[model samples]
Target: MILTLIAYALLAGLALIVYLSWSFSPRLTVGVAGLLSLFLAHGAWKIFRKPTKGRGYRALAAATTAGFTLTAATAVFVLFYGAGCGCM
Candidate 1:
């Protein structure tokens, strides 16, 4: 389904961002994670903006939003919790 593809694409995009960031600066991994988290949240928002007439699509959208929310929260925690401590 289209929604599934969109969700996968978002996941792939986040993974690519993480990979690129890690390759470029291992020291800034937390910052990159936070950025990717924001991106995921944005993707989730976009997904929610689409109108879904079926229960399945609604459920999928909810799951995607929840996953993105968790990622964003974890990223923020990692960013602030690892600041200046070099605990990446």
Candidate 2:
């Protein structure tokens, strides 16, 4: 658990930063948030377990999955309380 704790702390810190950034400066906040979200999604996809496949195919699948996940997450986040609320 030290790793898990660190991970949770990091995610919490990121969420806090995102919230503050969104409240103070929406444009820059959105850009940063989007990039961060993409990075997280990509990383998660890369680590996901799946059947073995060619490198190119695996990369493509991961990217596609990440894109979908990000889209859905963004939608939920926006729908629950506008983008400004940062209610994650």
Candidate 1 runs further than 4 Å off: 1-43, 47-57
Q: Give the worst 10-residue stretch by lDDT in candidate 2.
A: 79-88
Candidate 1 lDDT by residue in tens digits, 1-88: 5544555555557789878878889879987668766767765885667664654545645666777878767656545543434433
Q: Cα lDDT for residue 4, model 1?
A: 44
Clashing pairs in 2: none
Give lDDT: candidate 2, residue 66: 72
Clashes of each: 0, 0
Candidate 1's error at 3, in angstroms?
Answer: 36
RMSD of each: 12.9, 9.4
For lDDT, the strongest prediction is 1
Cα lDDT of model 2 overall? 0.64
Q: Which lDDT value does model 1 have at 16?
A: 96
